[model samples]
Structures are given as C-alpha cells and as structure tokens.
Target: MKHQPINGQHHVSMLTKDAKQNLWFYTEVLGLRLVKKTVNQDDPSMYHLFYGNRNGAPGTEVSFFEMPNAGQTRKGTNSISSFSLLVPNDEALSYWASRLDSFEVPHEAIVSIGERKSLTFYDRDELTVHLVSAEKDNGIELVEPWITEDIPPKYVIVGLGPVELTVREASRTKAVLEDILGYTQVRTVPSMGDSKVMVDIYETGKGGLYTELQVKEVNDKDRERPGKGSIHHVAIRVKDVEELTEWAAKITAAGFENTGVIDRYYFHSLYFRDPNHILFEIATDGPGFEIDETFDALGENLTLPSFLEERREEIESKLHPIR
Candidate 1:
C-alpha cells in the first residue's frame, strides 16, 4: 500500500536542568517566543516549557522539560548526539554570532555544512545545538530579525533539518532508517566528516532538508547514558492522528515495539528506537500548539493534558520556581 508522504518537521523537545536558563537562551537569545508553559503530566513538579515562533505553531515548537537535580549525560555512541536549527540567511548568521558574543554565550566560528553556514553552541545544560543559515526553499515563512523592526509573530520552522547520532556501527541503524522508517539515502557529505560518518536522510519536504541523520563511529557504545544533557527522542512528523496510527502499526509490524499512541496535548506521538539504540518518535500535526491557547497567549500559562488536569496544584508545586 502506498502511504501518504510524511509532513514537515513538527517539533523537538529536550530535557533540561534549569527551565529559566533554557527560557532565556531560546526566547531572549535566539528570539523564540515562549509559546507554552505547562507541567509534565507524569511528574508535575517538573515544568514543560515550549518555545517557538510567536504562536507556537506546530513545526516551529521546541520544548524542554525542566528536571532539577538530574545528572549530565555523556553524549557518546547510542544517543542523538546533536541537533541543528535553521536560520533565515547568512545575514542572520552574523546577527546571531554578534548576539551570542554580546550575551557572553561562548560559541564557535561560523562553519560550513553542505551549502549552509552554521554556528555551533551549547546551552547551559550542555546539549549541543547548531544554528544554520541557508537558502529557504521549503516555502515555510521565517521571521528574520535582521529584516524586521520588531520580532515577527509567527515563523514556520520547517521542522528538523538534521540530527547527528554517535553510534558504534552505522549499518544497523541505517537499515532501520531506510527499510523501516522509509527514509531514502540521498548522498554522503564528506565536508562534515570531522572524525565521523555523516549520512543524510531525506524525509517529507521539497528540497530534502526535513530530516537528515549522521552517525559517528565510536569504539565504545555503552559509554553513553541518557540524562539531562542528551536528547530524549527525535520526533518525525505525520499528517494527523490517522497517519500516526498507521505509522505506529508499520513500526510494530516491522518488529519494533512502539509506545503506542500518546496524547501530548499539542500532538499525539508514538516512540520507538532504531537498531543503533537511538530513540525516535513519530508525531502527529493535529491539534497543534494553538489548541488550548490563542496565538497571542500561547506560552502564557501552564497547560496540561486532560489526564493530568486534576493534579494541577500538585504538579505546580513540584516545579522548581522559575522567575
């Protein structure tokens, strides 16, 4: 059976130690708006903060879970090692370099990836993130600070561009991405080989920038541990709930156990893993970040899923105070 093409990248969330620091980095530094602030349904004391363009649109949203007292993660083989963010243009690259310096945030010089220019930096929690400025061909609108007098209200994120993982062997994981998830092997970019094997995977998009996976070969795979500084899971987008269900079954049928459908309030999700031991999630685009709140008031309150609605007070109490 022919399935519908996967939608654009939806969102990516990370687990952090300090919610306030992450808020400042994503909102104040990177200029993403705080679209939602809610408590984790499973553990309410920890806050789930969502940041993105002004309205917290589906593809633009990037969320974080503030878990206090969590140990740092050793980003080695067996983890989603690093994530990249897309900027508008090269002009934005210069703007971001200056901004990071002015804010006293240490960052590396602009580096070239394929035809794009990127600035590599780590957040307060030590998660590696990159800002890439490339020609926008996906038709998704972006808020260019260098062009606007005021920060724009909404900028279409165009989903995840690429994620690099450290792994012991790339062949097994490569099979999962190709045979199971249906990603095509585009080409190898040797320019990114700084002691790692960087492979690109093309997913739902016009110019093949939606999803790319790079795996680095390492001697020890068991050294990596999941914790605060590592990615919990990298999510790929599907059209809607039905698409998500179909994809979940596909995953299960392929002999991988999926977490099943999970109502994330903003989107439904199912979790699984590739052969290399990196966690992956297939997420829906329906009932987006704009569901409970207006475009203008997206991050104004601590929103929760209906399952955790009755524990609002308890969840609020558990969260570390973020001023």
Candidate 2:
C-alpha cells in the first residue's frame, strides 16, 4: 500500500432533464433514498438532487444537476460514460435483473469482465448504470443499502464502482489517473471484440476506487460534448477537511487546476478537471447528510446551504416542486 490519498469514489454527479422524473427513476426504480434535496449553489435557479443509501452513506451517493433546458449529451471519445455500483453476489445480480424487468426498465443480460459479473442498464436520463456482482473474498463492498419495502436489502446497490471514461487515447488520461491521482495501473486489456481498443484499469485504496479508460484513436472534432444525459463529475473521497486540504495542495503542486476548497455544508470540496477536460471532485467524508436533519427525516424538506439561507423563499420560487 502506497498510502492512498483517495479512499474511493464519494459520489458521481450528472445532469438530468427533469427533477421529478430524476427523483422517480432513482427512488422508485432503483430504490435509492433521496438523501439530500437542494438547489445548485452556483445556479440557484436549478436543482441539485442527491440519492444515497438509507442514511446517506459516503460511497453510496449519486447526485445530479437538474438542468432541464440544457442540450442533450453526445457520447464519444473523452467522455465519462457510465456509473456503476457493487452487488454482493451473482444471486443478487439475478434478483436485480428480474427487478428491473418487472419495472419495465430496459437492462442488459448479465455479462462478465474478468471474474466479475455485471448487469447493465440506463436511468431515465439515459445515464448508463452497472451493477457488478462480487464475492466477499473479492472485497465485499461497504454494504450499507437503503432498505425499502419492495427492494430487498440484499439487492440494494452497495457503493460506487469503476466509472467508465472513454477517452481519445490512454496516455494523457492514464497519466492523470495513475500519476496525479495516486491510482495504480492494474493492467491494460483488450476491449470487447476490438483488438485495437485498449481498456486500461486503475485502482485506488484497497478495492474501492476503480476507473476504466476505453482508449481509442479519435479526432479532436469527435470528442464528447457534455450535456443533459452526461456526467458532471466523479467525486473521490478524503477522510476529512484536513486530508482534503492536503490533497488540494498536492493537486496544485502537481500542476493541475483545482478550485481550492469549498464548503458544501455536508462535506468540504475541491474540484479539478483531468487532462482531457473531464471534471473531477475531491470531497470530505463528513459532516454528512445528518448534520442538519435527523436520519429518519433526511431529504424530507428542501435544505439550503448557509450562504443561501436568507434567500430560501426566492430560490424555492424559481424551482419546480419535486416529491
């Protein structure tokens, strides 16, 4: 162990066309609890939705930037394609396959990558999602799941897995992931049936943070265009504000542009972009979703950061109601 800075993925944030539909899809379809319901701090006119486990655990978060009017995403090289979650075993994967089928949500049959079994699907915004089945010996993920009536606790998505980043080539992107972020390059493997395409695997602390780079030759004009159905950023985790600031200093020293430090109320944040312009965030583990509200009452009401406290009514007026 080379003293890992990033524990693993904290949360992945993306854009959605409709807040209500976003809510329904993650909560009703996927069975995630609406841990935090707030507005985008930068553009308070829009919403920022967060979905996580029962108590809004650290690695279980998947947030969104609800920008209904924004243009739709164009997938290509240099894009963060999908967000994945860890499932306990092959049986849990089978349960989810049938679960999504019953909901009429389109999903792919179980597939294999190395020794791992995965079930792929898309959310309402066309965001790609994967549920990877793993055994305890394969590093059983942080197992806190949002328990609800219909969704068995066994099948609830445990935590964030490898996020797929399809870039123009592997060199720059791999350097950023491995060199700058302190991730180890596990190996380079062939992608699908295309012997030309190389999928590079990078792993962080233990087995939590993983990223797959789908490297292919592409022209500058064909680079991915971020929009409605695209990922905003993937946040990696630090233990607390102290570790976060230290990482910030290291990131800046490594000749990368970082947003310094920000107070996100729930956690401290530092934002940066990789070599190919894919945004990345480094957020603290706590004070978490329970800072202001009780665990049982989490996400029950709209919450605002301290800076926006006085303008609550104004912010609420500009946004659409989501249940």
**Top TM-score prediction, candidate number:** 2
Which residue pairs clash within candidate 2?
78-167
Q: Any residue pairs clashing in model 1, and if so which?
A: 9-159, 35-298, 35-299, 36-299, 45-318, 45-319
User: Where does model 2 exceed 4 Å of error?
Assistant: 1-4, 189-197, 208-221
**Per-residue alpha-carbon lDDT of candidate 2 for residues 1-323, written as tens digits (9 for 90 to 100):** 13345777888999999999989988988888999998889989988988988887778899998887878678777777777877767789899989888878888888766666788888777778888775533545555688888877777777777677776665787787778778876766644323355666677777533333333434454777788879888888888988888888888988998899999999999998877777889899899999988999999899998899999989989988886
After aligning candidate 1 to the native by TM-score, how far in Å is the CA of 98 from where it should be?
Answer: 1.0
What is the C-alpha local distance difference test score of candidate 2? 0.78
TM agreement with the true structure for every prediction: 0.89, 0.92
lDDT for each residue of candidate 1 in 1-323, tens digit (9 for 90 to 100): 56666655666778898888888777766777787888775677778887765565555667788877779786567777777777656666677777778888878888775666777877788788877664644543454222123333232122345677667777888778767767667666642325245555445444344455565656554758767867877777787888888888888888997789998888898988877778887888777777787876777777887888787787777665665
| Error of model 1, residue 59, in angstroms | 2.5
Q: What TM-score does candidate 1 get on C-alpha atoms?
A: 0.89
The CA lDDT at 300 in model 1 is 73
